[model samples]
Target: MARRKRRKTRVVITGISGRLGQLLTRRLHRLEDHEIIGIDRRFFRRRPKDVEHLRIDIRRKACEDLFRTKKIDVIYHLGLMHDPRRGSQEHHTWNILGTQRVFDYARRHGVPKVVLLSSTDVYGPQDDNPAFISEDAPLLGAQRFSQIRDLISVDMMAQSYFWKAPEIETVVLRPVHILGGVDNAMSNYLRLQRPPVIFGFDPMMQVIHEEDMVSAIHAAATPGLRGIYNVTGPDALPLRRLVGLAGKKPLEMPHVLAPTIARQAWMMRLLDAPAAELEYLRFAVTVDGSRAKQLLRLNPQYSAADSARAALRLGAWDAPSDAANQAEDSKGATAA
Candidate 1:
């Protein structure tokens, strides 16, 4: 009898032009059995030769043509927008409708697995939150922060796929503040020369290194794993300690005046995030990652300090000099 050859897994990753998408693409491309297909409206700089990059909106009819033609084994949904400055209607349409289209394509194409990169911020920072929130907790992240409602809607849509399409293994990962060379709000804040802080408030925070988050996504995309999981780093630390780890000083502001100042900054286009994001600075929204550890067999390799250092473009996994990275981060903030 002749030996049989295995087929390559065809993987589709949306938002493939973002920093995290670039990281995931490199990791997956290294695997000989994986064929990478990137879908995004932005340019994929330094794109890998073997990988296919499609610069198109996920909401467009053309996005469905990819599913119609190829045998896509898995879909990594990382296309959810998070910029607070974008209009609410635009955000909702892009996130909710675009995500619905992805799920519809998966169902129609018979894709066996779908992995969504949701954020722990969907849980919303609150004073009454448990010490460690589990997967079953209510998503109140948008209760006060209306801007994130689209994210919450997308998460709920993915969750609905669990029961609606049982054949497709839907895995939603709500990772805590993701810190690295990425241009997210948390990373950008840490890169600030003197990051602002709520006076007399130092909430406990959890963060995952960008690489660890990609690892968790890979684990979730495995053959048998399904359902929602809260992915977290190895440890948690206070907000001030995280800021200190990033080699920055905290400029404390009284809680009463912080929102007003944030609004002014927003009006003057000085702040990347709106005043509503300040809620995260005052309360905790830590999650329990025991499910991911036991089920997905995920063991985070980065410490809180290591993650914080990565945000500043320092340490072993450094990308570029702080000056260069800060400039790029500012230029690329809303691009993703």
Candidate 2:
């Protein structure tokens, strides 16, 4: 008996050097019939097997040359840079001008589909925000934080392309805090014993496992599903209780002084989260995952609590009491 050959789908993934991008590329490659073309501004240290990695900034002329020659079936725009030192000229140049060039080229080059990775941070964490936010929620990302605010415009651009181009299918995934993976910045911060938190405003928090986030992107990349979807785990929990569930003690810090302290922390590389990120921890910004469930049929295997536990299970974590676990378990159940 001879092995039958499967038709390979030509998939192009940007930001292939990052953890999330690499995860998506690796998983997508597991399918026997998908060829991966990876593009990144920086070099990827560990190149995955069968992936055609290109170290060309999307804004550069070399990138344009590749776009001219390659026939891209679907372009995964996961190239947005999220760092403590974000909002620099380089960040803005790449995220704004860089992505615009890619989008324009994709459109002109007859790419039939696109998968964009946006963030829940686009919706600012307002004190009066609804407990569950849907895709229709207004994008009120913090104007004071250039890093986060820049994402809002990028997200808007992707959405506009989705509506404007009926010829191409575009699916945008707006996921909440992406945690529980070894390489995630947020997860590493939480893995430390006694992670910092706002003193008087421990608002509710929600997280999606790295696996779930990738799954949502996978679902969106499926042909014919073209729309914006809020992707998250099943449950949302109070920030204080979530810390408890993660088996980590919270380092209480006054909001007024947190910026100064967080700046030092960021400098030390102990906490990758900038002071601007504290607003999100202080105010709840939960997203409604109904659209993902209905359209993408994405059933997240990890709940909010599950994600925290996995992320904070590092050596520094303290074991919770049985009674405490029971209480947190109930809270998680109600959240679900």
Task: Give residue 105's error in model 1 in angstroms.
Answer: 0.4
Q: After superposition, how far is residue 218 of candidate 1 from its true place, in Å?
A: 0.9
Q: Write the per-residue lDDT of candidate 1 for residues 1-336, one digit (tens) a residue.
A: 498778899999999988888888877876778899999999998798999988999989998899999999999999888877788899899999989999999999999999999999999989999989999999999888888888998999999999999999999999989988788889888988889999999999999988889888888889988999999886788999999998899999999999999999989998888898999999999899999999988776667777888898722234436534643564475356
Off by over 4 Å in 2: 1-4, 182-185, 267-270, 312-336
Task: Please report, in order, the local distance difference test score of every candidate based on alpha carbons.
Answer: 0.88, 0.78
Q: What is the C-alpha RMSD of each candidate to the true structure, in Å?
A: 6.6, 5.8
Give a tens-digit lDDT track for model 2, residues 22-80.
77776687666788888897777657677898888777777766668978888889888
Give the CA lDDT, 0 to 100, for residue 157 in model 2.
83
In angstroms, the error of model 1 at 310 is 0.7
